[model samples]
Target: MLFSTIVATSRAVGTTRSRRTKVEELRSLLAVLEPVEVEPAVSWLAGEPRQGRIGVGWRTLAGARVDPADAPSLTVSDVDRAFTELAGLAGTGSTGRRRELLATLLGAATTAEQEFLVRLLTGDLRQGALEGVMTDAVAATAGLPAETVRRAFMLSGQLSVTAAAALTGGADALTAFRLEVGRPIRPMLASPAPSLADAYSRFGGDVSVEYKLDGARIQVHRHDETVRVFTRTLREITGSVPELVDLVAALPCTSVVLDGETLALDPAGRPRPFQETMSRFGAESAHDLLLHPYFFDCLHLDGVDLLDAPLAERLDALQRVAPEHRIPGVLQPDDAAAKAQFEAALAAGHEGVVVKDLTAPYAAGRRGRAWQKVKPEHTLDLVVLGAEWGYGRRTGYLSNLHLGARDPDGGEPIMVGKTFKGLTDALLQWQTEEFPRHERSRDAHAVYLRPELVVEIELDGVQVSPRYPGGVALRFARVVRYRPDKTAAEADTIDAVRALLPATDSG
Candidate 1:
C-alpha cells in the first residue's frame, strides 16, 4: 500500500473528535493492508514504529531537510525497510549513516508524508489513533469482537503482533494468545479513589487492601533457569535488575509470573525515595542502592494460568509460591480495618493503599475500578511561568503549563516542573485567550509569561530533583483550578514546595 494512504488516514483521525469516525478511518486503512504491511502500518498509526526508537531526534531531522518529491510513490514497505535499517545502525559513523538514510527517505516523500515521517521518528505522532481505537479498528476489519482484540493485545503485550494475528488468522488466531511463561503480559492497572471510605464502600467487605508502594512496577517471568523482568511499559530490564532476576528464578515452581513493586530501602527499613528506586532501572549494573521486590499478585504458576482466576485464587497462588515476598495486605477487611491498613501503609513511608475487589479477575492492561487506589492528595497554588503549544486534540491551545514556586525573598519564581494533565476544554480555551496578555517572550515550543498567574495544582507529592532550581519537583501534578483570588507573590514558596518532599528525600 502507498504510504500516502496511511498519512491521509492519520490526518483524518486527528482532525475528528468523534470516536466512531476515528475508528472507521483506521478500520478502512487496516482493511486494505497486505499481509507484510500489517504490523508496520498498524504500529505507525498507533504512534509507534515497529522498529522501536530508531535513534532519530528532532535535531537530526531538522538538519537533514530535503525538498519533497513532487509525487507520492513511497510504499508502506519502503518506509518500514528504511526504519529497520536505521534501527540496525550502531557504533562509529552511525550518525552520518542515519543522516544519509533520513535524507534519502525524506527526498522521496511528499510534503505530507515527510511531516508524518518526522513525527513518527520523533515520537510525536499523537493522532487519535490510540491503542484502544486501533484495537477496535483491527477487530472491525477482521470481523472479531473488540474484547477479543483487547484480550489478545493484553496477553501478547504488543498491539502490532495482535493486529497481525487478527488480520491474518481472524478470531481463532487472537484467542490463541495465552499467558506464555517467558513472555511478559501487560500488568493490570488500578483506578484512583478519593478516599479509603469511598473505595471500601464501593467494593463492600470482599476486598483486599494492599500497600500501594512508592516504587517502580515490575513484572517478573521465570521459566526454569531463565528469568526476565519487565517494566510496566514491557521494556525488558533483566540486566539492570539481577537481584530481582535471581529472586524470581529461585521460586519453588519451575515457571511463574509475578506482578509487583520494587524499591530501595533505608537502613531503618523504610522505603527510600521513589527517584532512588527508579535510578537503578537506568543503570547497567546493580548499585549499592539495592531494590527489594514486593510481590502483590501471581499471574502464572507452574503450568497453570491464573489470569482468568479471581483475585482470591491469585492471592492463594502468590501465598504458596512467594510468601516471603508478598506485599503487606489484609484480605476481606471492613471499612474501619481498611482505613487502618491505609494508615499503616502511609506510616511505612509508602503510597497509600489499593483496595481490590476479591472476585474480579485480572483485567490486564485495563484501568478499571475493580482495583481502587486511595492516596493522600496535596495541592499547591503555583505560578504559571509559561505554556507550550499543544498537539493532536489539543491543537492550537496552550496546553502544558510551566509552573513555578514563589521565592520568599522576592528574587523570582523558581522553576519547579511542568504539567499538562487535568486541563478541561474550558480551561484550555481560557488559557489560550488569557495567557498571551501576560506573555513576556515567545519561542517555537512555548510562550513565556510574567509568572503573574497563580493556579491551584493538585499533586501526589514532591521529590528531590536537581532539574529544578528549588531542588524539588512536584510528582503527578495536575491543574485543579486557576487561583484568580491569589497573586504570584502569595503562591506557595520554594520553601513550601521543598517541605512537601518526604523527610528522607528532602535532604
Candidate 2:
C-alpha cells in the first residue's frame, strides 16, 4: 500500500473523538496492509518507529530545514529501511550523516507526510490512540478475541509482531506466543488499595499479604545455563549487572522464570534509599552493595509454565526453586492478621504491603483487584506541566509546580493540580538550573514544560473541581521526589486519581 493511505487514515483517526470511529478507521487501514507491511504501519500509527528512537532527537529534527515534496510516493518499506540505517549510525561524525539522510527522507515527503514523520520521530503523535487501542483494532479486524491478542502481546512482548501474527494466522497463531524460559513477559501488575483494612475486607478468605518492597522490579528468566534479567519495561540489562547474573544462574532449577525485586540493605538491615540502589547500575559501590532478590511469583519453573496457575500454586513453585529468596509473606484470612502484617511491613522499613487474591492466576499486564497495594501514605507519580516563579527567600527560582495525570486513552496528560510544598532548598536550586532545559514556553509568572518530567506527588486526597480538565483537583499535593527512572508515559492516570474521590451515601 502507498504510504499516503496510512497517513490519511492516521489523520482521520486523530480528527475524531469517538473511540469506535478510531477503531473502525484503524481496522480498515490494517485490512489493506500487506502481511510484510503490517509491522511498520502499526508502529508508525502508534507514534514510534519500528527501528526505535532512530538516533534522531528534538534538537536534530528542529535543526533540519528540508522542504516537502510536491506529491506522496514513499512506501512504508522505504521509510522503515531509512530508519534502519539512521538507527545504525554511531561514532563521532555520525550526526552529519544522520542529518543528511533524515533531510533527504523528509525532502521526499509531502506536507502531511512530513508532519507525520516529524510526529513519529519526536514521540508526539497526539493521535489520542496508542498501542492499547491499536491492539483492539487489530483484534477487531482479525475477528479474534481481544483477550487472545492481549495475551499474545503480554507473552510475546512485542505488539507489532503479535498484530502481524493475528492478522496473518488469526487466533491459533497467538497460542504459539506462550511463556518461554528465557524470554521476559510483561510483569503482572497490581491495583491500588484505598487502605489495608479495605483490601483485607475485599478478599478475606483467599489472600496473601506480602511485603511491598521499595526496590527495582526484576524479571529473571533462566534456560539451561543462561540467565537474563529484564526491567519492568522488558529492557535487558544483563551486561550492566554482573552480580545479578551470578545470583540468578545459581538457582537450583534448570529452566525457570522468577518475578521479584532486587535491593540493597543498609548496615542496620533497613532497605537503602531507592537512589542508592539505583546507583549500583554502573558504580562499584561503597561497602559492596549486595543485591538481594526477593521472589514473589514464578511464571515458569523447571518444565512447567505457571502463568495460568493460581497464585498459591505459583508461590509453591517459587518456594521449591528459590526457597531462600522467597519474599516475606503470610497467607492470611482474617482482617486482624492482614492488618498486623501490613503494619509489620511498614515497621520493617518497607513500602507497605501487597494483599493478593490467592486463587487468581497470574494476570500479566492487568492491574485489577486480584492484587492490591497499600502504602503508608497516598503518593502518586504525576507529570510536571509547568513551574511558577518563587518570591522572597525563594526569589527567581521556580517553586510552584503544575502537575498532570496520564490520560486513560493514551492522550496527553490531563491537568489535575499544582503545588510548591515539600521541596527543599536543594530541590529549588536544582529546579532553577534544570527547568529552563525543558521549557516549552514561558511567561512572567510561570514557565511551561514539555510534560516529560515525572514527579512523585504525595497528597491528602482529591476533590470535585470545575477548574481542571480532569474534573478533580489534588488536595494538598506536594512533591515527594523526582522519578528520574520513570517516564511521563508511566505516570499515574486520571482514572486512578478519580478513584480517590470522597465516598457517596449510596456506597
Candidate 3:
C-alpha cells in the first residue's frame, strides 16, 4: 500500500465526530493491506510507530530539511525499511547518520507523507481513532466479532499483531490468544466513583471494598523458577527489581499471574511520594530504594485462566497463593461497613477505596463501571500542550502552561485552560530548558509543543466555555506533578472534563 493512503485516512479519521465514520475509514484501509504489511500500517494509522522511539528527538527532526516529492510513490515497506536503518544507527557519528536517513526518507515522500512521517517520528500523532477504534476496524475488515477482536487485543497487548491474526487467520486465530504464563495481558481499569455511599447504592450488595494504594501498578508473572514483572502498559522491568522477582517466585503456586501495586516505602511503611516511587520504579538499575508488592487480583493460577471468573473467585485464588500479600479488603458488607473501610483506608495513608462488584468478571482493557474508586480530590491527567516564559522573580523560566484534555474520539487534544501554579524552582528550571525539545511551533508568548507530555493537574471544577474546543474550561487548575510513567494516549479525555460541569444550565 502507498504511504499516502494512510495519511489521507488519518485525516478523515480525525476530522469526524461520528465513530461509525471513523471505523469505516479505518476498515477501508485495513481491507487493502497485505498480511506482511498489516502491523506497521495499523500501528502508524493508530498514531504510533511500530519501531517505537527510534532515538529520534525534536532536535533531530527539527534539523531535517527536504523538498518533498510531488508524487506519492513511497511503499509501506520502503518507509519501514528506512525507519529500520534509522533505528539501527548508534554511538559516534550516529546523530549525523540519523539526520541523513530522515532527510532521504522525507525527500522521497510526498508533502502529506512528509508531514505524517514527522508526526509519527516525534511520537505526537494527534489523529484520533487510537487502539480502541482501530480494534473495531480490524473486526469489521476481518469479519470477526468485535468482542473477539477486543479480547484478543486485551490478551496480546498489541493491536497490530491482533489485527494481523484476525485478517489472515480469522476468529479461530484470535481465539488462540489467551492469558499466557510469560506474556503480560492488559490490566483491568476502574472508573471514578463519586462517593462511597454512591458506590454502595450502585452495587447494592456483595461488593468488595479494598484499599486503593498510591503506587505504581505492577503485573507479576511466574512460571516455575522464572518470574517477570510488567507495568500497566505491559513494559517489562524484570531486571530492575530482582527483589520483586524473588518474591513472586516464592508464591505457593508454580505458575501464576498477579495484578498488584509496587512502591518504595518510608521507614514506617507509609507510601512515599509519587515522585520517589517513580524514581525507583523507572530506574534501569537497583538503588537504595526497594520495592514491595501488594497483590490485589490473580488472573492466572496453576494453568487455570481466572480472567473469565468472577472477582470473588479470583480474590479467593489470590488469597490461597499469596495470603499475606493480598490487598486489605472487606467483602459483601453493608453501606456502613463499606464507609468504615473507606475511612480506614484514608486514615492509614492510602489514596482511597475501590468498591467492586464481586460477581463481575475481570474486564481487561475495558474501564467498566463494575469497579469504582473514590478519592478526596479531583485530579485529571492532562497533556501539556505548551508553556510560556516566566516573568519578574520567575524570569528566564517557563512558568505558565497550556493544558488540554484528550479527545476521546482520538483527535488532537482540546485546549481547556492554562495554569502557572504548583511549580517549584526545580520544575521551573527543568521546563524552561526541556520544553523547547518538544516544541512543534512557537510564538512570542508560548512555545507550542507536540502534546507528548502528561501531567497530573488538580482542579477546583469545570465550567462552560465558548473559547475552548471542548466547550468547557477548567476551574482553578494547578499542576500536582509530571507523570513520567504515563503517555499522552493515556491522558484523561475531554468528556471527563465536561463531566465536571454542573447538572443544569439556564443557557
Candidate lDDT values, in order: 0.86, 0.84, 0.86
TM-score of each: 0.78, 0.93, 0.95
Better of 2 and 3 by TM-score: 3
Cα RMSD for candidates in order = 12.0, 2.5, 2.1
Model 3 lDDT at residue 478: 89
Give the C-alpha miss distance for residue 66 in model 1, angstroms.
0.7
Please give the lDDT score at residue 126 for candidate 2.
Answer: 34
Q: Write the per-residue lDDT of candidate 2 for residues 231-330, one digit (tens) a residue.
A: 8768777776678788888888799999989889888889998877767654543336777789899998888998888999999898888888889999
Candidate 2 vs candidate 3: the lDDT winner is 3
Misplaced by over 4 Å in model 1 are 91-93, 126-129, 378-507
Writing each residue's lDDT as its tens digit, candidate 3 over 1-118 gives 8888888998899888777898999999998988888998988887777887689866787788689999999989998888778878899999989989888888898888888888
* True-structure Cα RMSD, model 2: 2.5
Question: How much is the lDDT of residue 21 in candidate 1?
Answer: 86
TM-score computed on alpha carbons, candidate 2:
0.93
By TM-score rank, best first, the candidates go 3, 2, 1
Error of 1 at 14 (Å): 0.8
Question: Using lDDT as the measure, what is the rank order of every candidate, best first?
Answer: 3, 1, 2
Cα displacement (angstroms), candidate 2, residue 227, comes to: 1.4
Candidate 2 runs further than 4 Å off: 8-17, 91-93, 126-129, 282-287, 432-440, 505-507
